[model samples]
Structures are given as structure tokens and as C-alpha cells.
Target: MPNVSKCQSLYSALVSRFQSENPSLVLSDTISSWLYQSIYSIYETSGEEEAERYVREAHMV
Candidate 1:
């Protein structure tokens, strides 16, 4: 599984892409707070097994 920093970087990249296409939408603190919660939830709930599964699935793709 990727470390927290790596995940954060990916999240930032995703946010950048969203902002680029939706110029009128601004990513404020609230948006970031929600994103953090969502990301952490995925990690906390799925744990290592799910992460490894996802990695393998991605490799197949």
C-alpha cells in the first residue's frame, strides 16, 4: 500500500485536475476536510488486504 504522503500527492493531483476543468469551483478548507475523511475511511476500513487486492487489480488493468 502507498504511504500517506503518496496518497496525499495523488489526492492533490486529482484536485488539480478537477479545478482545472471547473474553474468556477474553488477547493476550500471544507472540501479538503471532506476529502481527507474519505481517504482515511478507505484505508481504515479496508486495511492491508484490500489495498493489496486493489494493487493486483490495477496491475491486471
Candidate 2:
């Protein structure tokens, strides 16, 4: 659980850094697209439970 939290924090920080560097980036749109891509990729290569967890965690952030 600690590792999961760490990864989430890292992911959030990376997203924030990217947004700060690219001021024109639209976070909502970018995150939506990323979420779609992530879900599709996960579904293609991993189990449904893991994919669902990822989506849930991402949303929680």
C-alpha cells in the first residue's frame, strides 16, 4: 500500500511538472485521453482487476 501511494504521488508530481512546463496544456483533456489510453492498454495486456484499480486510483488523485 505504501508503494502504491508512492507511485500515485510520483505520477501526480510528473503530471504537475508537465503542466507547469507546458502552460498551454489542458489538464482535463490530457488526463481524459491518458485515462482512455491507459485503460485500453491495460485491458489489452493485463487483468481487469488490475486495470480497474489503476483507473480508480488515478481518479482518486
- Each candidate structure's TM-score, on Cα atoms with residue i matched to residue i, is 0.56, 0.42
Cα displacement (angstroms), candidate 2, residue 54, comes to 0.7
lDDT scores of the candidates, listed in order: 0.56, 0.55
For model 2, the stretches where C-alpha displacement exceeds 4 angstroms are 1-27, 59-61
Residues 3-54 of candidate 1 have per-residue lDDT tens digits of 6874565456556656666777676799777765555556567764454343
Cα lDDT tens digits, model 2, 3-43, are 34444444465456556667776668777567555655664
Candidate 1's error at 11, in angstroms? 1.6
Give the clashing pairs for model 2: none
